[model samples]
Target: MEAKNPLILTVRLDERSQRFFNEMRIKYFPPERNLLDAHLTLFHQLPDTNETLEIVQNSKRGVFEMGVIKLINLGAGVAYKVDSQELESLRQDLKRAFADRLIPQDKHGFRAHITIQNKTTPEQARLLIAELSESFEPFTIIANGLDLWEYLGGPWKHRGYQSFNYLDK
Candidate 1:
């Protein structure tokens, strides 16, 4: 049997939001298992191909409207749900482009979010969600680029980044 090649594609957020999410992950996520910085995943397991790379490289940058903050019940953990039409549209475009290559998870509707904690007890997740939700607020985040990474089991290795160039509208 061939070993599966796990690749992750994600949207690169603006500096401020990126830092905020990363900090949250650092503070809340299980230190032993928190191998990756916070990120908004677009495709969980994309195939490594030139076509995929081209699509990311040609993607345009846009301002994503970060909607209300809601807690996601991850069963074993929780996440901060981020609503963004612009980001969803981009993901849809990519989905269509790689329709045949998409995995089952990627075939479904894209739910943009930043997972601050995972692989923990449900009770712990609920406590953190409640604590965080009290002060949560909506904000805007810039989708400046697409990031690709090779998922080496638990730890992901950086593969490449395709920065989006915004066109004057």
Candidate 2:
């Protein structure tokens, strides 16, 4: 069997959204296990090839609106849910472009989200969800670019980012 590649592709969030989500993670996520900042993953794993890079470079970046806040039960953990049609469209386009090389997880429909806490007790997850829900509100964030990373076991190594054209109004 061919070995799986550990490259991950994600959508880059605007500064404000990034900071906000990072703060949430810092507060809720276990410090010892939290190895990454807030992120919206597009593809969990893609084959390490020139074609993958080309696909990212050719992809266009657009603004995405954040939908309602909901709690996601991750078995023993939890996450904040996010919905974006623009992000879904971009993901579909890339899915088609890399259909032959995408991993099983990436081949499925994309559900954009940023995990705030994971790998904790179910009770803890429920408590955090309840706490966050009390002050939840919908918001919007700009999709600035596509980021590629080499998944180094737990810690990810930054590879590069392809920024999209932003038209100022």
Candidate 3:
């Protein structure tokens, strides 16, 4: 079962970046797209609120600037890739600070991607992925704050991610 309060994670993205994503939605992912806005997802929720708040409050805030990377299809869905060295460092710092709350372990193999759509078949998905991957270009954005969002569920529930809190970084 999904968490009662839902699985919350911290993400950072600006209005410009958000707009770019929205345009992409029109040309690529549409209504019932089952896609999420682009952002860097930090650590997930911890069972204990006291511990979670303490860790987040005490954690060092670091600015992350990411170069735009195209979403590539890996036989699943499309995702944005973050190739910036500095951003990776921030990711590592977050992993270390939220060691216990980390939903997935840190690994050498990581790419920042936002799934744009859900397809019925893998073959059809591959075709669309190829087109998007080729058309995407590099964009740059800076992340200065952390936002906590909860995933409600389903492709139709994309906007259901409501911010629970914000932390300046």
Candidate 4:
């Protein structure tokens, strides 16, 4: 990978929940353009450096349950809103560490979500949202760890995973 490529950090969901979301994403997202399975990104871009990897690996967040609380309309897509105060705290910790290097979007507030459909027409998105809402019920998913990825241009390559160790595994 190029040294200049950015890194992306995401919360790794449990296997069961991840499979469920991946299915939804595949069913709703445009197949031809979908680049990744469903995921909740914590940081969109971080300098590809050892310091970035070290900071993430040293995170102290424990495994926690995150609520897949709400279904949201992304105007041109659909997503599931996830919530966890613990997750927010983790983001704050990393945000402070990368204070000077943060991009505009990462500098602002962070909202956790996993998009199921995107890059589609608003009308198509609305229809999917309506269909999903009819059967949607809030659920909780386990956040097992952090996933560090090397962003090569627009594609991502998984680098490593740092599992949360607060609870016995």
Candidate 5:
């Protein structure tokens, strides 16, 4: 079988969101060798070839300014607090765009959470969540860019990401 052309997706992130993730990294997430940009992915697992090109070409253009909010506790090793309306709209638009090629299905029913770190032991996860909850307040962020990227591998291995497009608002 032909090697999958690195699972590609498009996304955007705001400054505050990025900072939050960075703080989480400094506090708990292990330093990664090849850390890519922080973004809220809009699409994933897109098939390859001309169809991918067309999809990218026809991708909708818009600006999303999402405010910072607590990412309340997400069960099963996830937590966050937010009721971001703009983020929700962007997500919906993405789902509509890639309805044919990629299916938007999350094992946990799409809980909006910025993944601080994956592959954590239950104890570590709990402790991290508690500490974050204690220190977490609320903030706001203005996102003015959209980007296209391809995942290099699951989440390990060097050269974890490759940027394809960076669209400004």
Candidate 6:
């Protein structure tokens, strides 16, 4: 049987991008709730099983760049909007492969993003959105691999990681 703890899948960002987003998260997110480093979640729930691990580790995906298109006012938080056809294609491949196992959130529309702030007042969120928007410029971040994490109630535990079929630059 699948473990009760669910799995989360994310696109691994390059070190520089990871560091930059983590810094933003630490500066803006409520500390008590900031349990994870910055991440771009692709799937919120996957079965925690050896099969799942094998499937992920066996992936042949190659590294690619994704566009950081804009900043989103997440009502009570802020996030950087992401867009890339290559990323979308990857998600769709996984979606189809795990169609029967998907939760509603994962099964429905997937808008890729990396949240920088959360768990604050809506007013505070609006202010941040405004402040960040003033200097917002589109950028790109490299997607180098896939990370698997086991949900630990509020915090997450690293499960495994599979680098895409290319050496890191």
TM-score of each: 0.91, 0.90, 0.68, 0.95, 0.68, 0.94
Q: Tens-digit lDDT track for model 2 on 22-116?
A: 99889988999999998889888887788888988888655556563576777667676777777778888999999998888888767778888
Predict model 3's lDDT versus the native. Answer: 0.55
Q: For residues 23-135, what per-residue lDDT tens digits would candidate 3 score against the true structure?
A: 65555554565356644555444343555555545545555667767666646455566567865666677567767655553333456554554453567568777787676
Give the higher-lDDT candidate: 4 or 5.
4
In model 1, pairs of residues that clash are: none
Off by over 4 Å in 3: 1-6, 33-36, 60-62, 104-109, 151-169
* TM-score of candidate 4 on Cα atoms, chains taken together: 0.95
* Clash-forming residue pairs, model 3: 79-113, 79-114, 80-112, 80-113, 80-114
Per model, state how many residue pairs clash.
Answer: 0, 0, 5, 0, 7, 0
**1-169 in candidate 1: lDDT tens per residue?**
6765677998888898889889989998999999999999999999877787787777766445566368787866778888877777888889988899998999997778889899999899889888877887766667778899998888888888887766668
Ranking of all candidate structures by their lDDT, best first: 6, 4, 1, 2, 3, 5
lDDT of 3 at 90: 62
Q: Write the per-residue lDDT of candidate 6 for residues 39-84, one digit (tens) a residue.
A: 9999999998787888788666788999999999888999999999
Looking at candidate 6, the ten consecutive residues that score lowest on lDDT are: 160-169
Write down the TM-score for model 1: 0.91
Which numbered prediction scores highest in lDDT against the true structure?
6
lDDT of 1: 0.83
What clash count does candidate 1 reach? 0
**Per-model lDDT:** 0.83, 0.81, 0.55, 0.90, 0.53, 0.92
Location of the lowest summed lDDT over 10 successive residues in candidate 3? 155-164
lDDT of 4: 0.90
